[model samples]
Target: MTVSVLLFIILAIGAAGYALGVRRARAAAGGDTRKLHSLTGYHGQSVLLFSAVPALVLLGLWLVLQPLYLDHRAGAMIAVADIPEGGSLDLVLADVRRVAEGLDLLVASGGMTEDDLAAMGAADSDLKARLGGVGVALAGEVGEGVFEAARDYRHATHGLSLAMAAATIAAALAGLVFALRRIGTDYRARNVSEGFVLLLFIASSLVAVLTTVGIVASLLIESIHFFRLYPARDFLFSLTWNPQFRGGSDLGIWPLLWGTLYVSFVALLFAVPVGLLSAIYLSEYASRRLRALAKPAIEVLAGIPTIVYGLFALVTVGPFLRDWFAQPLGLGSGSSSVMTAGLVMGIMLIPFVSSLSDDIINAVPQSLRDGSYGLGATQSETVRQVILPAALPGIVGAVLLAASRAIGETMIVVMGAGAAAKLDLNPFEAMTTITVKIVSQLTGDTEFASPETLVAFALGMALFVFTLGLNIVALYVVRKYREQYE
Candidate 1:
């Protein structure tokens, strides 16, 4: 049976366990629910949790570990001599899996019988053709050892799948029996069910923590590989940005870092003032009808995809800046430039800053504004002194969030700011950021062993560190202001 089918059966069993538990509890109480320590629904929930949770957890773990075990066993079957030159075991194993899947498909399609498959030898040159006919494309000729390994892999996988299904169902049934035996008037069903719920909540929280750790660990590991191949000092401080796949590449990060900061600075410079002003207007000055209509219309910008913003930058904003400002001012005459990306990114970030700041501004206590007004302060003065100071921390948070969005932006930078990594002061000059370079480096067929490919990880790690620093600074600012306001 398939995993999904097994899961469905287990769930069905749990549902039955729930009904049995409820009936048993009611019978023990002699149909008087007041005699029971917990509600009928609590008793039912306890049974469902017991029957399904452990079985589901086991199934998840089994699914994760089974592939590793099968891969190891199948890899062991392939002889060292069978591996092609300059190709790793991973690549060969991938081919083995494809071939195994093809064989399974062939049998399922009725093109091959179990007897025919058992009688077939690796010496058959037409094996590739037969596999191809079934829609499995191999990179090269399948070796004798690889063919044998594929067959073994397929057999092992099928056997283990059945075993997994049986074990999972058995676990569910065992839990169902245990839960049913425990059902009684004196049973603490609510407490037990609530404990399971607490565990689930804790697990849900851990997922985010675990995911963050995983990302950092992966980036750190790959970045270490890159640093070992390339000098850390050169990567950090060198005033150039170029990568040659062959060798002798100048893999400097300074240029990219400068461009990133420049573009983000311009974006924030534009977005912060406009967004903050818009927030202030909407929150403190606008009428109720205007606020309702304007807020959603402004926020609609945030819902638009970044690619669409990028196209707008490329086709409209970029050229306009190049013609009207750059050429006239003799700064630079490039359609794609730092100014182009920064402006478009600023426009894109408006909703993020405006919506968040508006919420924060509105959250300020009404009493503070009343007090300011009673003190003979005008509406504008009240906003400036009372509401603005009160909402400063949250406004800072919103701005920081917008800045982070600008820093991590890739599509706008690629489309508006052309991919020319350089240390130029002119905003009208084309430039690129770390994210764009990270994408470029990892594009196409890449070998992770090489420094060029590995550098993408290093770039990502750098970006992560920079963003972390920004978060830290924002936190410190928030805490400082929040104390005074409170």
Candidate 2:
């Protein structure tokens, strides 16, 4: 069976088990809410874990090992003499699997035949007919080399699939029996099931933590590779930041750092005033009807995908600025520049800053405001002197989040910020960020062993560290402020 089919079947089994367990547990408890050992929902959840955990663990193991085993088998079968230039064994294997996946779909659809190669395109029919028509009319079942690899891979995969299925079935039976056996007089099924529920919660939380660790691990490994080629001094100082993949070139820190700071400063210029003032107005000034209508409308900016913002920066803002500001005033470049990305990114971050600050502002205790009012302070004075002071740390925390958001933004920089890695004060001049270049280095055709490819990793590590530090500081500040207010 295909992976999708197997996953669907597993999910269905888990859902059914959960539903049945809830029904049985509820019935067994004589419909007396107080007499039950656990809630019906907890019983359902317990059954889900029983049906899913083992199967998923097996599936994860299979996915990890399958590629290594396939590489081994493929290497053994295809001689070194048969491999082509500019082609890797992995690429060849990927091609083989794609064809195998196509064949599997054909088999599942019961559509296979040999047909004419030249005339097959003339047919108009359903997918099944088209597939069979192409098979019969265009070519043989598959090329000999591809066919060999596909058959071997399929045989091995099918064996594993059968074993996984058998294990899952046996485990499901055992788990059901075990759970029902424990359903007895004075049994604390609630405690037992809640333990499992908590395990599930930890499992979900671990996914986030593990993903972060994986990214950092990737960055660490990549940075090591990069540092091997470029010396620590060159990476840290020496002024210039032009990077090329060919020979040993001077790779310095100054230019990129300058460009990053310049862009960020411009973004902060736009975001801080607009976001903070909007937050103040929303929290302190807006009527209920105005708040209800305006808040979501303003937040609609956040719902727009980043790619769409990139497009707007490139097509609309870039041209307008080039024509109006650069050409007429002779300020900077005639194309994409740092200001374009900064301005667009700031627009994207406005809702982030405003929404968060609004919450923090609202959370400042009413007693503080009442005290200020009792002291004969005006609304503006109370907000500026008393409420804002109380919430300052949290607001700083919100601003820190916005700053990180600006730094990590990619599509806007790639599309609208100039790719030039030069040190310049002119916002109109095109500039590049570490993220924009990281995307460029990683995408398209790449040589994984080269420093050019590896530089992405080093840059990624730098980005991760910078963002992580920002987050930690923000969290700490927000927590400290909350404690003070409480």
Candidate 3:
């Protein structure tokens, strides 16, 4: 029984249990719903929750742990001599998994039978040819040790899967029986159902919190390893950003940080004014029909992928700026420049700002505007004094969100802004960001043990810290403004 099949069986059992619970509860109450301690739906939901949750939890744990157990068992069979020169345990284990999967596919697809697989050995059978018949390609010929390990892996996997299916089904059935037995006229099904719902909400929140903790812990560990190999002072303070995989590299944060801030500043400068003005007009002056039609059309820009914007910057905006503005103004004439990426990124962020700001502006009470007008104030004066101040906190939040979006963008910087990391005041000069450098450092054939590869995690940690500070500042500004209004 596969995981999917097992899940389906559990679901079918849960559904049947729900129906039975509802019917049994009504029967116990002599078909009088009001005589029951809880609603029919609550009884049904309680049974469903009891039947599904424990079984699903068991299934999830088994699936997660089964792979680790199998890998450990298989890895034990491979001696140091089994690994080829210039190869590590990870590489051998990868091949072991691949071969194991291929053999499973071969057996399932009827390309090989039980008797044939049992009799098969590296000396007796063409393992690669058999796998290929089932569309599983190996990089090289299967060695004797790897072939034996894969067979063990397949056997362990099959046994564990069968055991998992049986255990999960039994758990679900047991839960179903227990819940049905408790479905009496006096049972507190409503309270039980609400408790289950509360547990679900708590589980969802824990998943998000745990995910953040995992990211921070991973980054911190890898960054510590990175700092051990490379001096933290050079990485943090040095002005240069040269990462040589061959050693003696100056892996500094300044150039990348400078470029990130400069590009984001330019983008915010372009987006905030235009987006806020557009929001003001839409909220304060536009007709309902026009606002409805125009808002979605403007928000359509948000749906246009960042990659598409990158291409737009690369082909159209980059050249246009270089030919007209940069060259004519005696600035740098590179087609790929910070200005190219910044302008395209600003266009991409317009919808985020406009939509959020428009909603915030509209949320300002109509009574405030009316009072401002009654005080002999002009429409513009009313907007400036009453509506703008009221919407200031939300507007700040929107701008900060857009700024975060700009700072984290990679594709536009890659395509429009060139990959040269430098600190320059000239917008026409090509530069790169931390995200782009993070990507560059991690890619290619760079060894993970090297400081060059580890620097990616350090860069990531810095980016995380910067974004956290930015959010803190945004919250402070918003709170200050909100207090004044209150």
Top TM-score hit: 1
Query: What TM-score number comes out for model 1?
Result: 0.97
Q: Where does candidate 2 have its weakest 10-residue lDDT segment? A: 114-123
Give each model's whole-structure lDDT. Answer: 0.93, 0.74, 0.91
Residue-by-residue lDDT tens digits, candidate 2, 152-267: 66566668677766665566556655665555334565676778768879999999999988988878987998899778677777777666666666666567667777787788
Worst 10 residues of 1 by lDDT: 477-486
Sort the predicted structures by TM-score, highest score first: 1, 3, 2
lDDT of 3: 0.91
Please tell me which predicted candidate would have the highest lDDT against the true structure: 1
Which lDDT tens digits does candidate 1 get at residues 1-486? Answer: 777788899899899989988998999899999999999999999999889988999999999999999889978987888788888888889889998999999899999999989888768878988999988888777988888899999999999888888888899989988988898888999999999889989999999999999999999999999999999999998999889888999999999999999999999999999999999999989999999999999999999999999999999999999899999999998899999999999999999899999999998888888888999999988988788888999999999999999999999999999999999999999999999999999998877689999999999999999999999999999888884543
TM-score of candidate 3 relative to the true fold: 0.93
Task: Arrange candidates by lDDT, descending.
Answer: 1, 3, 2
Clashes of each: 0, 6, 0
Q: Which should have the higher TM-score, number 1 or number 2?
A: 1
Please give me the total number of clashing residue pairs in predicted model 1: 0
Better of 2 and 3 by TM-score: 3
Q: Name the regions of candidate 3 deviating beyond 4 angstroms.
A: 32-34, 123-125, 137-141, 287-290, 483-486
